[model samples]
Target: MGLEQIKNEFNAIAKTIYFDKAHFLREKASDEKAVRIFLEKVERLLQENDRKLEELYFVYGVFGNLYRVIGHPKKAIHYLQQALCLAERENDDSRKVVFLIRLGEALKYNEEHEKALKTFDKAMDLSDTLQVRKYNDFIFQHKGKCLLELGHLLEAEKCFLEALHIRKEKGDPELVASTELAIELVKKSK
Candidate 1:
C-alpha cells in the first residue's frame, strides 16, 4: 500500500480500536486475547508505515491503559512514557495530556509520589491550556491522590475539592462522590 493509503488505513484502524463495539461486549470478556489482538494490529500498522508518530503515541497510550487495567504498573509506565515522548515530539497537546495522565496514574500506584505529582501537574496545566474540561476532574482527582500520598493533607484536600467542583459542574455524580470520599480521607488524615 502507498504511504498515504497506509496512513488512512492506520487511522481507520485506530478509530475502530478506540470506538469499536466489540470492545464493549460484556459477554466476550474480551480478555487477554483481545488486548493482544489490538496491540498486534497497531504494531503491524506501525511496521507497515513509519511516519505517523502521533498515531504511534496514541496506540502506545492505548496499550498502556490496557496494561494498567491488567495490573501491570511498570509496563504501563514504560509504554505511557513512550507515548508521552512521542506526543511531545508531535506537539499534540491533547495526546500529551493523556499520556501524562496515564504516566501520573501509574507512578502514583507505584508510590512515586513526587514524580507522579509533577506529571499530573503538567497534565493539569495542559488541560487548562487546551480547555479540556472533560478531563479536569480526572486530573484533579489524581493530583489529589498524589498529594495525599505525599502527606500533603491540606493540598490534597484542595485538589480533591477542586475535582469535586468540576465533577459537580460536569454532572458526573459518581466522580463527585469519589472526590468527596478523597476529601474526607484527607480531612481524616489531618
Candidate 2:
C-alpha cells in the first residue's frame, strides 16, 4: 500500500482508539495500554519507512494525550514535546495548538504551572493567528486551569466564563454544565 493508504488506515485506527478511550470505555489504565498498542503499531511502520515525520508526530500526540489522561505526567509531557517539535517543524498551527494544549495539561498536572502557562500562551497566539475558532473554548478552559492553579482567581473565572459562553453557543448543555462547574471552582477558590 502507498503512504496515503497507510495514513488513512492510521487515521481510522487513531480515531477509534481515541474515541474508545475518551467515551466508549472508562478505564484509564486500559486506555493507556490501548493507546500504546496503537503507538507501537505506528512505530513499526515508521521503522520500515521513516520519511513520515508528520505521521509519527500524530501517533506520539495520541500517546501523549493518553498518558496524560492516565495520570502519567512525565511520559505524557515527553511525547507531547516530541509532537510539538514536529508540529513546529511542519509549521502546522493546528497541530501546534493541539500538542501545546496537551503538553500544557501534562505540565499543569506535574505542578509546572509556569511552564504550562507559557505553553498555553504560545498556543493561544498561534490559534489567534490561524483564526482557529474550534479550539478557542478548549484553550480558554485550559488557560483557566493554569490560572486557577496559580491563584489568579479573577482571570480564571473570566476564562471559564468565556469557555462556558462558547459551550452554550454550541448548544451543548452537557459541555456548558461542565464549564459551569469549572466556573464554580474559580468562585470557590476566590
Candidate 3:
C-alpha cells in the first residue's frame, strides 16, 4: 500500500478511538488496559507497514494521556517526550506545543517541579511565537499550578487570570470554571 493510504487508515482508526475517548475511559474499570490493547493492535499494523511519523505521534499522545489518567506519570512523560521529539523533528509546531504541555503536566505530577516549569515555559514560548491561542491557555494553567506550589501566589494568580481570559474568549465553560477555581485557590492560600 502507498504511504497516503496508510496514513488515511491510521488517521481513521485514531479518530474513532478519540471520538469516544472520555466516555470510554470514564466507563471502563481498566481503561489503560483497553487503551494498551488498542495501541498494541495499531502498533503491530505499523510494524508491518512502517509509515506516517505524524500518526505515530498521535498514537503516542493517546497512550500518554491514558497513562496519565491511570496514574503512571513516568510512563505518561516518556510517551509525551517521544511525541515531542518526533513533532520537533517533523517541525509540527502545533503538536510540539501540545506534547510539551502534556510532558510538563506529567513532570509536575512526578514532583519534578523545576523541570516541569522549564517545559511549560518552552510551551508558552512556542505559543507566543506561533500565535496559537487554542493550546496556549494550557501553558498558563499548568504554570500557574506550578507557581502556586512554589509559593509565588501573585505570579500564579496572573497566570490563572490569563488562562481565564482565554477560556472566556473561547467560550469554554468547563475551563472557565477551572480557571476560577485556580484563582480561588491562589487567593485562599494567601
Candidate 4:
C-alpha cells in the first residue's frame, strides 16, 4: 500500500503489458505504431530505478531488431551496437555472438559491406571459440548475404553452402529451404 510498493507493482505490470504488446505488434509485420509504442514504453522503463542491465540489453537488442525490420538500418546499428557493448561488458560470449550477427546484418543493410563482414568475422571467431555451433549457420547466412551484395559471388556461395549444410543437419525444413534459396540466388547471379 506504500508509495514505493505501488510504484514497483505498477512497473512490473507495465513492463509485461507494454513489452508483450510491442512484441505482438512487431510480429505482425513490423507495424510502425508498434515501433512508436515500444520506444515510448522502453524510454519510460529505462527511467525506472529497478531496470537491470540484462533487461537493458534485451530492450536495446529488440529495439535494434524492430528498427531493422522497419528498414531503418542506421537506427538499428546504433541500438545493436549498444546491445553488443552490454554483452561484452557482461562477458557473455553467446550473447555477444548473437548481437554481432544482428549488428552485422544492420551494417549490411546500410551498405557497409566491409564493416559488416568484419563484424560477422568477429561473431564467427567468438562462436567458434565458445564451441557454440548453434549460431554458425546464422553467421554464415548473414555473412553470405553481405558478400553477395558486395559482388563476391563465389565467396557468397561458399558461405551459403556452409549454412545449408548446417541447416540440413539441424533438420529444419524452413531453414534448409531458406538457405537453398540463397544458394539458388547465387547461382543465378553467376
TM-scores for every candidate against the unseen true structure: 0.66, 0.71, 0.73, 0.77
Residues 1-190, model 4: lDDT tens digits: 3334434543443343221132211112324665556566665766675656766676677667667665688998999988888888889888999999999988877778899999999999999889876999999998987887777999999999999999999999978887887787778779
Clashing pairs in 4: none
Candidate closest to the true structure, highest TM-score: 4
Candidate 2 positional error at 179, Å:
0.9
Candidate 2 residue spans exceeding 4 A from truth = 1-54
Residue pairs whose backbone atoms clash in candidate 2: none
Provide the overall lDDT of each model, using Cα atoms, as 2-decimal numbers. Answer: 0.70, 0.73, 0.75, 0.76
Preferred candidate (TM-score higher): 2 or 3:
3
Give candidate 2's TM-score: 0.71
Provide the lowest-lDDT 10-residue window in model 1: 19-28
For model 4, state the Cα shift of residue 57 in Å.
Answer: 2.6
What value of lDDT does candidate 2 attain over all alpha carbons?
0.73
> Candidate 4 — which residues are off by over 4 angstroms?
1-30
List model 2 lDDT by residue over 9-114, tens digit each: 5565445432122221211443446556655665676668755675677667766766665667898898889888888888888888888888888888777989
